[model samples]
Target: MRPIWVWLKGPLPAVPWPHSESRPDVDLTPEHVVVVGASLAGLRAVEAARRLGFPGRLTLVGDEEHLPYDRPPLSKEYLGDLPGVAPMLATAEDLRELDVELLLGAPAEALDLTARSLLIGGESVAYDRLLIATGATPRRLPGSEGLSGVCTLRGLSDAIRIRAAFDAGARVVVIGAGFIGSELASSARARGLDVTIVEALTTPLVRAVGAGAGAALSALHERNGTELLCGVGVEGLEQQRGAVTGVRLADGRLLPADLVIVGIGVVPATGWLAGSGLELENGIVVDETLRATADVWAAGDVARWMSPDFETLLRLEHWTNAAEMGAHAMKNLLDPEAAEPYRHIPYFWSDWYGHRIQFAGVPTGEPEVVTGSWTSDEFAALYHDGDRVVGALTLDRRGDIMKYRAMIGRRTSRREALAFAASRRQPIVAAAG
Candidate 1:
């Protein structure tokens, strides 16, 4: 069967799609840009707009009270309770210098795409260009809501609470073996806490890195003293007087726990645009230019746009994609005449138990070829769909990954990738350069 992405492929929208074309009354000035979701993507949108010479009313709205901060650290150093590991990306002075009107702690209640206005805090804010960077929220397990001692780490506050649990030496039961759950387990194990990770899949990160690499990661955690319960589904949460105490598994085993963290994944924050006439699927569907509707654009995890390079629509949740997509969305918003389709090679990295795992490109299909040993702490795996190098993953081999990143970017043939991978030549730097 063809891949889902192939099935979803369609013709790219013609240049100057509706609401993307220039209008006489439309204010193309900087101050007219309204960015929702005060996240890494949202903050970058405002900054990129300014850099693109958008000089007008620039307003940023966010549901969280805290200013934009780094989220990836929340699972690593922040979870370990390391001092001075602030995730703040921009300071108050920085926003002021950028002339960004930041409206923190105000959630967007409704969106008027036709009127090009956003309703927040009982006020309608008009905008010539609206960028939705609301990102995503952590998926919660059923019956876990309203229960104390249960947390989903998505924000700074969530990380703090989980850190406190770790500080208390709480027995942690993570409900997914994905990136977040695995990283949290690593942190909990580092603090000498009894950690257990339950994954419905056969291995960790099978979706991102494939079963082979995922199994290697699963073993990595097991070597670090984390209990691995793979291929088991959680039936429900066991609670004691409104507080979580344990997790009930599908096979009738009850895993006792002091704290439970659900890392099942996340859904895009597109609920506010429900009746606003924007097409919604896993995310807000946009054209090749990332325009959701007339005068409205979206970026980050919340916006799913057609990938001209990959030949399918993609909504990436990684930090790198969010920042790049935000800048691209804003640039197109400022200049629709010169608007270019969003084409990017997706990339992301995660730190787990003293190992840095980085991946570039899509990593689609099976693990067709590998450059080095997977059991080793340092190696790189090159994934291919037939003769085309689609993606690559590296374990502590940053330099090697960059080479494969370029190969995938150039759409190198499988023969070339294999030759590069199998070559016993020294100094890959010269060959790659």
Candidate 2:
């Protein structure tokens, strides 16, 4: 509840709130660009639009009061001992610099996309270029401990509550062993707090990283002393006086904890765009250019564009890809410069325990693994698609991974690409080296 200082790109004194637009607000005009969902991608999109000489009125609407801050820190720096320097993506004053009209604490209830306006609370704001950056919300479980301490780590408020609980020396029980869940467990363990991660899946991060990477991540968590419980479902939550005390697993087990962090996954916040005529699958279905059919564009966690390598239209939740896609959307909005199809190979890095883990590209289907080592612990295994590097797992290898990502773009044969494993140097952190 306290407005802690978030360092951001510069030294930002902490002020609070939280962006996106998928539905094009055609009624908007310098005149106006109403950006829904004041989130990472939303703020970035706002900045990019203004930077690219968007001579228009800008209004940023969101459901939360917290300003544009980085979500990744909720698991790493913010949750850990690192303080007074947490990097918030954008600050309130930053909005002033961009001349962006701020509408905070107002939940956008409905989207009149046809009328090019948003019915927020009671007011209707008409816009021209609407960017639906409504990011995903935490998937809440029914009858599960809806307690004061039972929380999720997605937005700023969620992180603040969890941090306060951790600071108070609460033993945290994290349900679901996905990315956010695993990262939360790592941070809690790093703080020397008792932490247990419960997952119904056989392997943690099975959906996100697949089995191979999940195994490595599990090992990392084990090394950090985080309890990883898999293939167990949560039947219900133990509550007393409306406060969660613990969770009951489907296996007839009760794990005791004062604080519970549920990071099951996120559902795309495309509910406002419902019946808006813009295709909304898992996310807003955008073409290669990050455009969702009409003049409306989509990016970040909410905007699911086509995956060129997969040869299928897919929504990506990776931070790197989201940022890149936002940039691409901005470029296209200004004046698209790409000749061929606009494709960005997905990449993500998680700082857990003592390792800054990074994964590049999608590893959905059967991928032939090239090279890796668990003990010495420094390697990069390229995932080959018929002799072409479709995906790669990088352990401590930073620089070469960039080149490997470029190789995926060349459409090279998988066999020829993986042949250089022995000759190449191992994975290195981009910052360290």
For model 2, the superposed segments whose C-alpha errors exceed 4 Å read: 1-30, 84-86, 334-341, 366-369, 374-376, 425-433
Write the residue-wise lDDT of candidate 1 on 1-433 in tens digits: 1111001122222333223235655544434788888889998997787666555667888887887898998999887756636689988777776777777776888998778888887778788888999999989988777899999998998988888888888989999998889899998988889988999987778788888888876788878999999989999888888988899999999999989999999999989889999999999999999998768899999999998877888989999989999999998988766689987888888888988988888868767535546676566777887788989887777777778888888889988987887773344444455
User: In candidate 2, residue 269 scores what lDDT?
Assistant: 87
lDDT of each: 0.82, 0.72
Model 1 worst lDDT run, 10 consecutive residues: 1-10
Measured on C-alpha atoms, candidate 1 has an lDDT of: 0.82
> Can you tell me which runs of candidate 1 are displaced by over 4 Å?
1-27, 424-433
lDDT measured at residue 104 in model 2 versus the true structure, 0 to 100: 73
**Residue-wise lDDT of candidate 2 within 1-433, one digit each (tens)?**
2112222232322322111133243222235666777777777787777666565567777677777777787788888787624457776667767777777777777766678777776777787656777778889877764468888777777787888888899988999887778788888888899989998888777666667667766787777788888899999888888888888999999999899888888899888778878888898888777776445677788887766776877776777766666656765654433313458777888777767777777775544445555443666666665656777777677766777777777776675676666556343333226
Q: Judged by lDDT, which candidate is best?
A: 1
